[model samples]
Target: MSTWRIRLSLFLNFFVFAILLNTVGIVIKRVIDDYGVSEAMAASLEAYKDLSIAVGSFFLASYIPRFGYRRSMLVALLAVTIASMGVAVITGFWITPVLYMTIGVSFALIKGAVYSTVGLITRDQGEHTSLMNLLEGIFQVGALAGPLFFSVVMGLHFSWNQTYWIVALLSALAYLLLLITPLDESEVQSHPEQAGLVEMLKLLRWPLVWVFVLCAWLYVMIEQSFGTWLPTFHERIFGLDKHIAAGMLSVYAGSIALSRFVMSYLSRRIPWLPTQLTMLGGAFVLIVSILLTTAGWQGTTVDSWVAVPPLAWVFSMMGFFIGAIYPTIISIVLNKLEKPRHAAMTGLIIIFSALGGTTGSFVVGFISRSFSTHDAFYFPLIPITLLALMLIPYKRLADRFHPASPGG
Candidate 1:
């Protein structure tokens, strides 16, 4: 198939997969209502999904090149399709943990392959980052649409489980599309000397890899915290109905998608440092705003949803900045590594990102329990600060080792 055909296939694949991956925020509310789980218990679902992704990535990272990207993604799509169908058919929400575990494992396979495939297609750093932004933008589109889709189904009085049926069908279609698109995996660089378990582990010894890993972990933590809990946050703080709460979550995802779409264009015109630093600065401002608004909510009474704090909008819209960090970091990391180790490095990225997602969700739940839901909003500030500080080192390391010149 043509290059554009391949990109289209991968784009659609991510679009559908995102709906499954980003459903945690809505599911948090569903499990609470349907299964009568506590807030912490409901939040534990993220650990199930993310920990499984980490484990799957660890086992499959070194072997993805041998398995071939196209084959691995097909299997991943099949696995998620089956799992979603099972979840839809199962009664009650007791099957939730198992369902998420299945989704997590499937995502690990798809992501490891997908990240590696980007390196194969792009000719240089600029192309790589732009493409990553485009793909992530598409993924956010799915994230944006997912909550709205959930709200519609629930508003129509359908059982929440029926939502998985939509996921299953979309995943199955993505599978067929990928199957038809031919991928030239033979073009992906491989080194016979660095194609095994020891070689992959050796990547961990590099300080730069650890830096990228930390960056990935922290970025995902912020992204998933909002993605997984924003709906509940709105519902609780604003006293919004289930559909409205979920719809507001879509607004957040939509902001991220919109920003990413803009970044896909702007990244080509602006230098990487300026574009990234500007987004981080925006995040710092918005997060501080969110913290201030939530802290001062003590004497307020919400007589109607309209009386709810507008900071809730800031909390959701912060995705504009949060969206760029992860993909931009992955793009930079991929540019730094030799192509031979791209698959292995991509696995590490997913592993740390999984770790971040797991930790962020749990921490938010813990803080909410210990203090209040508003207090949990403060947890992201820690990573946001660390992420901003780390960029200095990341830039220095990048310039020293991987100059923007082609084949650096």
Candidate 2:
């Protein structure tokens, strides 16, 4: 494939991924209610998912240079397709945790490889930022659309177990699309020094690398927290019916998708630091607003008899503003690393991200299960606030490693 072909293929692949990743968020409560599992066990679904991503990424990191990015992604696509089918095959309350865990692992392999491929197709910092922003926006498209698709499924009164099979079929289509598009993995730099294991390790240790890695990881946590628990929160905290609560969930995901898509355009017009700062600033303010709004809830109980919170629309709309984060952070981080090391760094970060997602979902699940989902709000704020503070150090780190933009 030509450069643009590779980039576009990878970009389209992200939409497929976003669909799979956010689908579970739509039916989380149904899974729990249907299967009789504890909150901790429910959380373990994410734990296993994270654990698999970490493991697969760690092992596959070295192979991008050896086999090829396209082949790696093809394998990942297959894993997701099979794993999704597996969930439907084994339907037990106790086994649901294990099934969800497999889903996490499959996504890890699929996404880890897909995310790292951006460095391969781009030639410079601006191209990196623009492409990542555009494609990551596509990812948000899938995330937003996944929930809406499930809403249609629920409307038809489809069972939760059947949904996985539906998602799996979509992934199978993506896998075939990838197979048809030939991929060429390029480490354009011929420097033998740049292509070794120790070199990759040194890059991973850099403060610039960690700031972005940590930022991306925790940001993912915030995303997953809202993605997994928000629908339940919407239903419980507000008095919306199931479909209506789900519509609110879609609104949040849709807003996030919209923001990320907008970032693609913004990246072309502005510098990375300023764009990121604005988004993070907005994120912190909105997060605080959400916290304050939830403070006067009186109790954790779902008073279905009462009206839903008026500010639900406000907070749901906030997701679009926060959507710029994941892609922007990746673009900033990859600017620091050379092409050859991008895959390994992607592998390493993905493990942590999976961990973050697992931690985010399960921790909130436990809190909700142990106390109330209401108590879970406090848990996400601390990390999200810390993520905002991280930008200061990130800006300095970017300056230290990369010179001021010539065109930027």
Top candidate (TM-score): 1
User: For residues 1-408, could you state the per-residue lDDT of candidate 1 as single tens digits?
Assistant: 357877887898898778887888679888898878899999889789878888887887767777778998999899888888988898766688888888888787787788878887888877888888889999988876776678799999998889888888989988998888888876553454555556678787766777778888888888878877887777776566666676677778888877777777777677877777778788878877767766645534344556556776667788898787677778888878776577788778777777788789889988988998777877888888888888778877776765224333
TM-score of 1: 0.84
TM-score between candidate 2 and the true structure: 0.78
User: Which is the leading candidate under lDDT?
Assistant: 1
C-alpha local distance difference test of each model: 0.79, 0.69
The runs of at least 3 residues in candidate 1 whose Cα sits more than 4 Å from the true structure, single-residue gaps closed, are 24-47, 89-98, 154-158, 189-193, 225-246, 293-295, 298-309, 362-379, 402-408
Tens digits of per-residue lDDT for model 2, 207-312:
6777777888788888888877887877676556666676677678778878877777777778866666677677668767777777656534344424556667
Instruction: State in Å the error of residue 146, model 2.
Output: 3.1
- For model 1 the local lDDT of residue 8 reads 83
Where does the lowest 10-residue lDDT sum fall in candidate 1?
399-408
Candidate 2: the clashing residue pairs are 49-104, 255-320
> Looking at candidate 2, what is the lDDT of residue 297?
61
